[model samples]
Target: MPDSISVHFASPAEMLFTDPQGRKLGKDPVHNVEYNEISGGVYYQESIGNPFPESSSQNDESKNIWIPEPVSGQYDIQVIGTGSGDYALDILTYDQTGNSKDITQTGNILSDITQEFELNYSVVSAEQTKLQRIVNIDIKPGSDPNSINCKNRKEVISVA
Candidate 1:
């Protein structure tokens, strides 16, 4: 069996949230926007890929990507500011008994801020960890994270 993990978030104002695979959640998502011919228009569809398909939908209050059998690895969960506002991001764990617990949370955050932290996870018997807080933001052809001050590494995994 695999542990249940989800990365979910919401903001005071509407903005687009994207997962590693480019699936998006938002009101009128211009990035990764998918057309729903049956609805007669387009919408940002939350897509859960790889091991399994998405079984739930993104609601008005929140949006999420559920990893039912998260492999032993690391991936980025991103927030793209189409609109701007303070937001809360949470990692949640669910038990088979129908209860949900928050594993971690980053709240009331503003964009373009940097802070260091560690996030870790396990699947079956494999555990992995990641360190650092990194952000890549795109401004109106103006503000960008100074390349000299930025650092990145390939996602790391550990198992025992």
Candidate 2:
């Protein structure tokens, strides 16, 4: 993995909701991290329909929420719909090594809003950089793509 973890989603039909516009990611209330847009911090990007105004590792319809130094606890991911359509939600995590895996969800939104996901992530108390802290929390259980981070793949049990 790298040094950032993100929760993001996207839909193709303009957007899910008209008033709220797109998704809003509410971080763990216990963690209370500040939200910033210019500098690197916890910030939410509301989508402006497909064919995004900018280029990214993500597709045109996607919007991302970054947690470069993810705080421990529960995270609430919500999708607000303008009407109704399908959407993809993902938890993009980086391992201590240079590998990544996305925990993804694809579903339909048939109401004003949908709060259908919860991530209860706990992590290691490493005495290192914020970057190292990110690596500590991205725990990938069993054999999966993220296991690329483990030196002894079979011995790697999830502590976080």
Candidate 3:
């Protein structure tokens, strides 16, 4: 088998949570989160109404808690909301000189325990420039197309 390079972010360092008013909440503790990785993508077994924890590494001196490290190839990203409403997943990517890109996945939270989604990003650079990427997942105030129903004790997974 090919050597697999995979890391699990089960702690606060891997997740970010927030309220409906855009206020940031610290990461919350969760239970029974199942992670699975395959050749083409990764999958997570998500329950319902499970809120993720926010970033705890923020301070006055060093505001940015999440750092972006770009690895060439394809990446599969996924996030599911355990709440009743939709949420936002904040993502940021930057270069060595501080050039950055911020992307947000809004209203994409899965209200149902059985529903999930994934994102694919291809990074290819012929030049000698390095790339960086950061991602933050949070819940949105409104909008629920899936109608999964977020209550409590929920889970979501992602793999790349």
Task: Please list the C-alpha lDDT of all candidates, in the order they appear.
Answer: 0.41, 0.44, 0.31
lDDT of 2 by residue, 109-148 (tens): 5534433345543333221212111122235656454443
How would you encode candidate 1's per-residue C-alpha lDDT over 34-111 as one tens digit per residue? 322221112232433434336463333555545554443344444444343556666665444334556544444433
Weakest lDDT window of 10 consecutive positions for candidate 2 = 13-22
Sort all candidates by TM-score, best to worst: 2, 1, 3
Q: What is the Å distance of residue 92 in model 3 from its true position?
A: 1.0
Q: For candidate 3, what is the TM-score?
A: 0.33
Q: What TM-score would every model get versus the actual structure?
A: 0.43, 0.46, 0.33
Task: Between candidates 1 and 2, name the one with more favorable TM-score.
Answer: 2
lDDT of each residue in 7-37, candidate 3, tens digit only = 2222112232221223222222144343322
> Which one wins by lDDT: 2 or 3?
2
After superposition, candidate 2 runs with Cα above 4 Å error: 12-60, 95-99, 125-160
| Number of the top-ranking candidate, with lDDT as the measure | 2
The RMSD of every model to the true structure, in order and in angstroms, is 13.9, 15.3, 15.1
What would the TM-score be for candidate 1 when compared with the true structure? 0.43
Give the clashing residue pairs of candidate 1, or none: none
